[model samples]
Each structure stands twice: as structure tokens, then as C-alpha cells.
Target chain A: MTDPDEAADRRLDANAAAGPLAELFTVDLTVAVATCAGCGNDAPLAAHLLYADAPALVVRCPNCAGVVLRYASSGSTLRLDLTGARLLTVTLAADGSVGISERQPHRPP
Target chain B: MSFVSRGFAGRRRKTPPGRLPPGQYDVGDGFPVLSAGPTPRTALASWDFQVQGQVDGVRRWSRTQFQGLPRESVSVDLHCVTSWSKFDTRWEGVSVDTLLADVVTAAEFAVAFSDGGYTTNLPLADLTGGQAWVVDTYDGQPLEPEHGGPARLLVPHLYFWKSAKWVRGLTLTLEDEPGFWETFGYHNYGDPWREQRYAGD
Candidate 1:
């Protein structure tokens, strides 16, 4: 159940998950902009809340408390769930700034 | 071992003595509050626990009825999948054994579900005997909502996620269906001693 009125925890943010996600994607996933499927709130993953103690690294939208990403690893197996993210726009400029183009998942809206 | 980044700024995680499990640091005196969702505020009047699925009949208990059941005090260690453990914490609650005593069931697996739509899978054996409880009090005080008030499942032997917070009920199942975290790659049977934090571990 996604609660739009959920209060975000002040102590934790996407930076807590940035390191592990960087290891997984080799690029900083927190730098990408994720649009929340629950409420269409567009924010950088850095603005999301990290639920650090879960079995997976759960990144939830700050606006709706809906999970935006779930990353988990067990030994050699790694899984990433982006079901809650409606769109992810990544900018891969050499300076790592400026959105030249946006890459959303190939799923219909 | 946990996948901690460089300069991980987690606080108060000091290394405790031999009482700790592998890859775990003690969060002494600090009861860490970590949840996948917002803390649910279920009032005691509306709160009820049920034992259903694969049972002969669903057994329901109102809050007053559950509180009236046989209660026991427990002192146990809690190991989180996040690689932190708290030692010798005290809790009071009705045992799962006592709750299931009158219910007839031949199910082999169980899924403990909570108020905020969280669920975790467990072998029925892990939930039976004196191993688990539906704890309502912690350190002799009514459990705080952040710490899963009203009642929460306490399976001290497994990693803390198996101890579902704001727990509402258990469903016995013939199939070993993975619940919430288990479907997401957490070890189905989270035995902290074996370091079963993830699925393939």
C-alpha cells in the first residue's frame, strides 16, 4: 500500500544506497531521475528515501512512499526491481551533467 | 558480510563480545527503527489476529482475547539482515504455540502478514514449539508503533525481518510461497547463524 501522505525519514536518503548501486550499475543510479509510478513525482534518486535495514536496498519515492527501486544480491546472483518507477531519465555526458536525452524503460504507459 | 560503502556513517554500531553472531555489530542501547514502509497505527480495538489457510477453520482473536491468553517473558538476541544485532532484549507476548494449540493444521509452511502489507515466509516448524511469539510489549513497556506496537511476530532465531512488525496474522500454506522480501532475494529461511541474509546464501 503506497501512502501519499507518508512522512519521509529525515535521517536516510539515496546517498546511503548510492555506493552499492554504483557497484551494481557501474554508474551512480542515485544520479538518475526516477518518476514515481504511484504519483508521477519526478525526482532524482538522490531525493528518495533509503530503507537500509530491509532485505533489499529499498529506495522509495519521497513524495508517495512508493518503492521506486529494490536492489538485492545473494552471492553471485543480483536482482533489481524497477516496477515502481514509471520512468528513469539518465544523462551520460562526460561532465555527468545536462540531460542530452532521456531513456525510459521500453514499457507502455 | 554486508555491502557497506566506504565511510559508511552508521552510528553507535560498536563491536560487542562473543555473544554476537557472525558479521554483526551490536547496536547497544539504541533500538534502531528501520522499516520498508510507514509505521502503521492500528488501534487496539480494531486489531485482531487470525490463524487461517490450510487450517480446519480460521481462528480469530480480538485484542482483549489475545491479551488474555497465556503470556511469557522472553530475553533474546535480535539479528538484522542489515548486519546489526541487539543482545538480550526483553519482550512479553503470547507464544505461537499457544495461539495454534486449539487450531488443527497439517500445513508445512507459514506466511506471517502484517498491518502495513508486509509478509514473510517461514517453515511451520520455525513458528511452532516455543521458538516464536506475537509480542506486544518490549522492555516491559507497551510496544511503540515504530517498533511494531499492538503486536509483532518475534522469531528470535531468524534474522529480524522474519519478525514482521505490526503483525496481524499467519496463514498456513502447503506451498512454500515466498513473501515480500523473500520474493525480492532474501533468504527464504533466514537463519542468522548461517548468515542467510540473501536468497542464495
Candidate 2:
């Protein structure tokens, strides 16, 4: 088997950013669709790469590696920056479920 | 002049007295692995470290050549912007002074770039006078990829983000540049003692 530690070899879900993001949004952010400003590719916020090893959590667009969102806390204050995302929209799942659903076509309009 | 909640108590860590900087907690031997991007694994045969930009000329070294250079064993405290401070962590690598000894440069700023396109900016003075190193070993083991292996820049005095991991080269500039976190909201100069963890603070 290949070295399990090799980077650029594996990808992670939004589990890392989900917890911190949950505290901010009442709705599940994992199901939200973010259009990458860099390339205009649309993907779920959960499918994006969450670089959690740094001082702050950075969510990057997997398509172009553009930063989609950044969140950090300083003492009692929290800061969030979203410059790489052109648009953010919530997409509901089948059977009226919200998050963690299988990928499906985004709703019309 | 504040009132306390009826059943509330402040959250505090039982840290060893006076050892930790403000708002920091001792991790107690567990060196946490944190990264802003995916870990990069470079082959030693193709790996090289360089110091370029604003210097008289670029300096390059292959993995074998760098390993042959003089190195130092350092035991220093590491303070992360996330309020975690690891004390007396051991590392082995060549100092920035040693690496820049032969190079001629008048630049006052430097941007440490890593293999995975991660970059962190610092002052030229911060990289000199034995303040920083490009380390490859931690705790007597070849540094792991998850923790910036094959050699990562070590600048312990500042927040760990300034010490770019998977560090590959330094690009010096006359003007100070904002790095990954610095461009975000992280303090420009992360001094743990002063608790400069954010841009304003």
C-alpha cells in the first residue's frame, strides 16, 4: 500500500469545518453550495477542502484552490472572510432532508 | 465591577506557572498536527531549498547538499495563534544565518514559500541572528509530512503560522508582504507575550 501520509493523495470531507461553521449558521452549512469565484465551479461547502491544521480554519475551492471561506477566533471575537465564493445557496435533499444527502442537481433558479 | 452568574465559573487550564504566554495552554507532550492545506510529500531526490528575490543571486541546495551543511539542535517554545503553546520542542536544522552567510542581500522582508503553495512573510531580521531555521528533524525523528517534512522553516518566537511548514524557499522583498494568515485576520506580527493573535490586537 502507498504511504498513507502522502499529501495530494487523499481528500477530506467538511467534517472539520462543519463544527465551527455550525456555531454560526443555524442551517447546515455542509449542504450549502458555493460557486468558486476563481473558476465558477459549483460544489457543496462540504466537498471543499477544509485546511484545519492552521491557526484558523480555511476552506478552499477544490476546483481551483481558491479560498472560499476563512474563520478564526480572537479571544471573545470571531472573524470570517469570504472572498473566493461568488455565490452561496442552500440546496435541499430528496424526501425533504437538508444536509448530508447524496449529490443532486441544484434546484432551478 | 462585574456580577458573577449564579452557577458559572471561568474556564481555565491548570498550566504550570509562568511558563506559558497569555491565553495559552500547555499541550502536555502531544504535538498537534495542523495544516492549512493538504500535506505535500516531495521526493528527496527532487527536493531542493532556495533563497531568492532581492538577493544578489539565487542560492539553491539539493536535499543531499542541505543535509551536509552545518545544523543546530534547538529546544524552544512554540506558541500557536490558536492559544496552544508547546514548550521546549526539539528540532534539528540549519539556521537562517548559516544559509544566508554566503548570499548578499539588502532586502528587509522575506516570504517563506512551501511546496504546497503555502506562503508566510517575515522580516529579514526575524530570519537572521539565529532566530530561524529550516528544520528537518523533530524529537530525533525525520520530520513527518503532516508536520512539514523534508524541511520546514522554524520561527518559534512568533506564532507557528509564521514558521511556514513544508517550507521550500524564501523570497526576500524590500516591502513587507502579508502571508496566508496575515492576509486573513491574523496579527501581522504574532507576538505571544503581547497576545497579538488578530489584526487589531
Candidate 3:
């Protein structure tokens, strides 16, 4: 079996890719809430495991290891994939402070 | 437009004379090993390759049986989504066409499942026509486990993550299905030239 500590050491949090995501969106992507389409797990993007060693940024669900988002930027062009996410909710506060809701919104009857 | 930070610029080398895709830097020698999971130690004796799902029937191959299949050597450029491109990487393996020659599938997509439960999906069209291979040797050496030894998918045109490491089998599907990284947020169809690394691209 592989060493758990070593594996953890190689992985980075989704926040590490925030700079690229911030360039595309007005708010920070790490603060956004993402729902994983694979395992139905909903959490803040910052909580996801991110692998940044490649030419692209790969974000996977901490629960199921499913890729949540992949962002690649080349020059002025930026590619963002959110197919693995059922939904991403980002709230902008009037004060300009980005608000990330930890709890997933309850479905209305 | 290129955001090569001062620190990153310090590490930059002169671009080679070939046609490289945008935002890609040439990294000479040494293919980096990056994995999202533990490197599985799969013994050859216990290793088998399978082709199933959306096919007429399941096809299986033992290690020896797989190596017995027609082999081809290819030299191709590898582009990782991380912005590094390795040129003229040579590999030897059976083409996906050879592996699926006997199996008839109406499936439009496939999910490459690997030893460590890692997976990446690709369109069925991408696996044929000499586009992809199940390579086991790199630079004439048996692939090291860290580098997805035994065998791994090689789809050079797309981001390297789409070329899953430690590949074991492919599950064909009538509809598109996201693999391990795809489920997290990787693009469904990764075309590096178009920079289709993500969904919006």
C-alpha cells in the first residue's frame, strides 16, 4: 500500500488554482459551492483535492476522487470544465466580500 | 497574454523549433510522474486486461496474451494540462484498434479504468484510427509503476490526464460518462489545441 502521508504531501487544495479561476470569474472559485455529479457530495471548492503538477489544474472530489473541475489557460484563452459538477453557486456580497455558504441550500417543497 | 511569472520565467528554456500548442513550455527529458492515488503494485501474473460494457461480450487478456497481440512503436509529443509539453516521447504498445478489432460495439464513448481505481473517459472515435494505444514501455523500458507501469492509455493529442495510468480495461458506453477526473471537473472532450481542458472551453 502507498504511504498516506506521502500521498497527502503531493496533493494541493483547490485554492491553489484560485488565481486562474479568479481571472475568469469575478469571484474566487475556491469560495464557490460545488455539487459533485459523481457522488452527490456538495462542498466548497476549496475543500476539494487539487493536483496542479500538470499543464492544467485538476480538481477532484475529496469524497470519491472524481474530477470536479479542470482549468487550463493559454495566453488570453482560458478553458474551464465543470461537467463533473452538478452545480456551482457563487454569491457576491454588496460589501464586495465573497460569501461562501457552507451548507447546501435546502430544496423547497 | 501569457502569464509567465518572474519566478516561472527563471525556469523557462528557449522554445523548440516545432509547432507547439499555446501556453505550453518545452520540458526536455524526464517525464514527470503525477498521480491522484497510491501507486498500486500489480503483479504481472495476476494482471489481466478486459474490454466490456456496451460490447457484444466481455473480452479478456492475460499478461502474456496481451503482449502477444500486434505491437507498434510510436514517437509522439506529450502535452500535460499543467502547461508542460514533452516532445518526441517514444512508446511501444498495442493500438486500441487491434485490441477492439474482434469486439463489435455501438458505443460512442469509453471509460478507461485503471489499477488504482483511477479512470478517464474519451470518445470512442478518439481511440481508433491510430489515435490511441495501450502502452506499457516508455523509451524502451518497462513503465515504472509510478509512471503507470504494466500498461496505460496513451492519447497524445489530449491532456495527459486523459491518458490514464495503470490502465486495466475500458468500459464502453452508449452515452458519455465521466471518469475519475471528469467527475471532479475535467472537460468531457479534452482537445489540447482548442485548449478544451475544461467544459466552457
The number of the candidate with the highest TM-score is: 2
Query: Which ranking of candidates, highest TM-score first?
Result: 2, 1, 3
DockQ of each: 0.32, 0.40, 0.17
Model 2 regions lying over 4 Å from their true place: A1-12, A15-19, A22-29, A64-66, A89-109, B1-17
Per-candidate TM equals 0.77, 0.81, 0.67
- Per-residue CA lDDT of model 3 for B124-176, tens digit only, reads 99999999999999999998787888999999988899999899999999989
lDDT of 1: 0.84
Q: What shift in Å separates residue B59 of candidate 1 from its native position after superposition?
A: 1.8
What is candidate 1's lDDT per residue for B95-133, written digit by digit as tens? 999999977878999999998778999999999889999
Tell me the tens digit of each residue's lDDT in model 2 across A9-71: 344555567788877777778778889988998988878877775667878887777778888
Quote model 1's iRMS.
3.3
RMSD of 3: 7.4
Best by DockQ: 2
Docking class for model 2 is: acceptable
> Which clashing pairs does model 1 show?
none
What does candidate 1's lDDT look like per residue over A1-109, in tens digits?
1433344332366767777876578666766889999999998887787777656778888887788889877566778989889999877877765443452332101
Deviation (Å) of B90 in candidate 3: 0.6
Query: In model 1, where do residues sit more than 4 Å from their true spots?
Result: A1-8, A11-20, A26-49, A53-55, A61-64, A72-78, A86-109, B1-18
In angstroms, the error of model 2 at B166 is: 0.3
